[model samples]
Target: MMPTIVFGVLSVIIIGFALAMVLSKNLVHSAIFMAATFVGVAGIYLTLSAGFLAAVQILIYVGAISILMVFGVMLTRRGDISASNLFNKRIISGVVVSAALFIILGRLILTSEWFPSSFSVPESTVGPIADLMMNAYVIPFETAALILLAAMVGAIILAKGARRTR
Candidate 1:
């Protein structure tokens, strides 16, 4: 009963903040809502007893990614935030497509056979997963980090060049 209640509240938080993030014009506000959504997702992970996933969600998505986005927006944003994504002819078409998608997804959900699970998740899966990531996948992880660094450097160079042109 308690878990179900928590899950319900978390779900509401997730959905509400996600919609707020999408609808918000201010980039900073959107980033804040995005962080809230990430937190809600972490709460759901906690409810499912996925402690590691919850930690990663909070650390990576909420802590790092959201902060990075907010800072990026603050630094790069010119006169107004709403300068981009202005309403146009695309709005009507986008609404129609999204509504059709929602209806199709709703039909799929209604028809799906979702029974209570007899199989339970294991108590702790952190150890083996940690070993695999740290030992076996270490190279891939380092490579990804290097790639991200290169992208950041490229962005900085582009920004500087654009400023010089202006």
Candidate 2:
């Protein structure tokens, strides 16, 4: 009962903030709402016993993406944000497509019979998983960092280019 209540609250908060993000006229406010939505998702992860995923979600989404979006908005826009009619042409189409996908996935989930794992992972396995990620997956992790670095550098160069042209 407690779990259901917690999940229900988290779901409501997540959906509310997602709607707020979409409807917000102010870019900064939308970014804030996006962060709130991300945090709410992390809470949901926590409720599901995915502590590592929750930590990563908070670290990456709230720490990185939220800041990056705000910086992008600040860099690109001037003056108060206004509601956009950008979705006018394709809104119905998008909704139809998304609803179709949702229905298909819901059907798959409902029809599938999932079996529980036979073996339980020891608490001690967590440390080894972390170690493996830090060591074996270090290259991919560093590559991701490099990609972020490249993006930052590209943004800087583009900003400088724009300033010089002005």
Candidate 3:
């Protein structure tokens, strides 16, 4: 009972923070709200007994990505409040596309008949996960690292160029 109540509260916090992020006028404030949403999601993951995922969510998303987004926001000179006219052209199109996708997904879920499986996940999945990451997916993981490195280098170059212009 207590767990359910806690889960519900966390869920509400997550949703509220996500909405706050979208509605925030300030880009930097939006980034901070997004970080709050990420932290809330990490808490929800903890409630679901996914400790590892919760840790990764907090560390990678809330810690690294949120910091990067804030830094990117700081690098720009744009003011906090954007005019309503900024989204005038594509709003209807975006809404229609999203609604269509939602309808399709809802239909698919409702029509699908999933069977109950007796199979259960292993109690110790961490070892296998690490093994797969190190052995099977190492190349792809390293490629992602290389891509991030390139992005970091590009950001540095752009910062340098801006400094020179000033």
Candidate 4:
């Protein structure tokens, strides 16, 4: 009963924040809402007994990605993050595409056969995951980190260049 209530609350939060992120005019506000959506996803991961994934969601999505988005918005010299016009000429085509996607996804979800797992939840997953990351996946992990670092550096350079041009 308690878990159900928690799940319902988290679901509501996730959906609400996602909608807020999409509908918000201010880019900074959208980024903040996206962070909130990420937090709600972390909570969902926790409810599913995937603590490591929850931590990763919070750390990567909320901590790093959302902060990057906010910084990008801040560094821009635009008068306001808000769109001048909410609905453009392409709005009709966009809505049609979105509706088509929704119908396709809904059909897939309803038709999919989900398996019921018989195995119990593991006691600890962090240690084994850490070992795998350090041993087998170290190279790929480091490469990903370097890529993110390079992207950040590139963004900084571009911002500086824009300022110089101004």
What Cα-based lDDT does every candidate model obtain? 0.87, 0.85, 0.82, 0.88
TM-score per prediction, in order, is: 0.75, 0.74, 0.70, 0.76
Candidates 2 and 4, the one with greater lDDT: 4
Per-residue lDDT of 23 in model 3: 61
| Residue-level lDDT tens digits of model 3 in 1-166 | 9988998999899889986786666777778899999999999888766677789999999999999988876666465345321434666787799789979998999999989567665576467778878899999988999999999999899989989999
> Which pairs of residues have clashing backbones in candidate 4?
none
Between prediction 2 and prediction 3, which has the larger lDDT? Answer: 2
Looking at model 4, report the run of 10 residues with the lowest lDDT sum: 80-89
> Compared to the true structure, candidate 4 yields what TM-score?
0.76
**Across residues 46-144, which tens digit of lDDT does each residue of candidate 4 receive?**
998889989999999999999998887787537755772244567678879989998999899999999968888788868878887889999998999
After superposition, candidate 4 runs with Cα above 4 Å error:
1-9, 81-89, 116-119, 164-166
Ranking by lDDT: 4, 1, 2, 3
User: What is the model-wide C-alpha lDDT for candidate 1?
Assistant: 0.87
Query: Candidates 1 and 3: which is better by TM-score?
Result: 1
What does the lDDT read for residue 27 in candidate 1?
A: 73
lDDT score, candidate 4, position 119: 80
Candidate 2 per-residue lDDT over residues 36-142, each given as its tens digit: 99999999988766677788999999999999988988877866556431344666787799789989998999999999668765555357667877999999988
